[model samples]
Target: MDSAVGRCREIRLRAYPDGMIQPSDLTIIETALPEAGPNDLVVRNRWFRISISTRLMANPDAQAVEGIPFPALRPGDRLADGAIGEVMACPPGSGFEIGTFVSHPLGWRDYAVVDAGSCVALGRGPIEPAAYLGHGWTAYAALTRGIRIRRGDTVFVSSGAGAIGSMAGQIARRLGASRVIGSTSTPDKADWMTAELGYDAAILRNRGSIADQLKAAAPDGVDVFVDMVGGEQLAAAAEAAREGARFVLLGALTAELNVAGASIVAPVQLDSFQLILKDVTLRGYSADRDSAEAFPEWIAWQREARLHFACSTVAGLENAPGALHDACEGRLRGLVMVEV
Candidate 1:
């Protein structure tokens, strides 16, 4: 008999109505690996964890109507940062080897049994697998397809020290931007952007009206805006835009507020006038769409040195909560991972 069973843990979010998510909003439960059916591969589950966007709860008024192809929660499932694991066993006729390292779109669990087709093999490489979490597709999507950023353009990026933003700035520089101006909250991050990443300049976002500051910094005005903080930032980007700029809208960290009504939950609103007049293009991106092109492109970028990546290391399933707390509190930067 299988002794007892291989045990794994999962986090389930309670019904949170106010967009509130704390460590207590998560419930940790022990569960056993699913018995693999046909063509199933049971991974020993090495490293896996969550990102902040996936961990936050949403009220219906502010809830996204839908997300990408990631499966929705069942009766017992939850939304959290995902992880990578190693294949320890495979059912007969499954083509996977037992020792392959793979990443799947499952939550913070110790062991996972997934179909062979559901994962991407972590080939022997210099790039860390977890770096592929947000850093991989995100930077590629922003520059290549999302913004169509060109050489000799001026690019303005928000949250410039973050996982996606930092890589995006570097890619812009390599892709031949004449100048890359980034906005960060502190002098320390601004200095890091300029000195370490080869950025042309960085403005301290907390110091002044970002719109006026960016306008003052870019006498020619911005040609591309890779925006993460919406509301005032978006409004500012729109105002500071030169003729024919491409504004790639990626996030809304400043959008959500607990307004009394559905329409008012977010203070961020976009005016179509500037986009129409200045020949400015606004577009939103999700990585899963057209990943068929992105994956190979990403592999090439990393190989060619245009893309640099990093991740925060964690160990074991027991530390999931603490790791998540660290991520939330800004103690760790880049994508967070558990080494198992």
Candidate 2:
């Protein structure tokens, strides 16, 4: 019990360069127990979600995309990410108590000292914390803010089996989309998307041309596209887009391919004629900013919809590097989580 109540282990980035992330670039350091300040609470992290963009923050060659609020990390800085944790300590009137489940943006560590007001208590529920961290509010935000989901629209989601994509496919159908198609790299993922995730069609990205796959999946064209992997996928989306379609640009999982000299210029190139002639409306999405505005509605949706999200977890603090490496390399599917 004492071991669980005290000091914490943190993963710190030592150096960042382009290409694959090495375990050596990260170092684990032990520190004294984190003390909560006024209006602050200390949480013992239960899970941390590993994402591609979060790994890119540790890459020196990664250029920050405009309008994306990537936390600036220095060599000695603790890598910041999203995690679900339990409040271990809080101020007397903080409204949070020991064992109260909470979520925060500070991860890559065993403990988080987060502002009391900023922390959200998950309360007693069947909703798993890992699910909340992965696709809970983000799924709602993606549908509402990323693009207006009109009833009976044909929706296509890239990276369809991953956290956001999985949720997008289901949510679009719930919102009355006539057909929901997904793009995935593996045959297993494609099967999972169409079978388990309720996607109407699955386009295997590695099997052949993405454009060709999309064309076959939705011959009439997609009315909305939820893009999680930018690059050729984006171009493919444009090619398969219907006239007046809405394209929601969410994540650039492959943007590292364009990283050069501290700049990320035109990492994703879309066909101009397809976009122009189709009169496509492109919108960028940010869960962090959009979530705050939709928090109340998101909470309501969670209860009403009873949505479920799954994660593939890596155990222990030491294995965080391996999880991050897998995410950066596009080797992992769904939400890559770390259980502390």
- Choose the strongest candidate by TM-score: 2
Say what the RMSD of model 1 is: 3.5
Residue-wise C-alpha lDDT for candidate 2, range 288-310, written one tens digit per residue: 66555776687767666755565
Candidate 2 regions off by >4 Å? 1-6, 61-69, 124-127, 257-263, 268-274, 306-308
Candidate 1, residues 1-340, lDDT tens digits: the string is 1226766666665444334344655567777667777877777666675565543333333334343343333324565445566777777666566777777776477677777887777743343664556565676677888879877999988877766677778878877789998877778777877877667888876587887888877878889998866777778878878889998877655532212311222356566787788999988765556444677677666767745564677776667767765665555645677766
- Against the reference, the lDDT scores of all candidates come to 0.67, 0.76
| Candidate 2 minimal-lDDT segment of 10 residues | 257-266
Best by lDDT: 2
Clash pairs for candidate 2: none
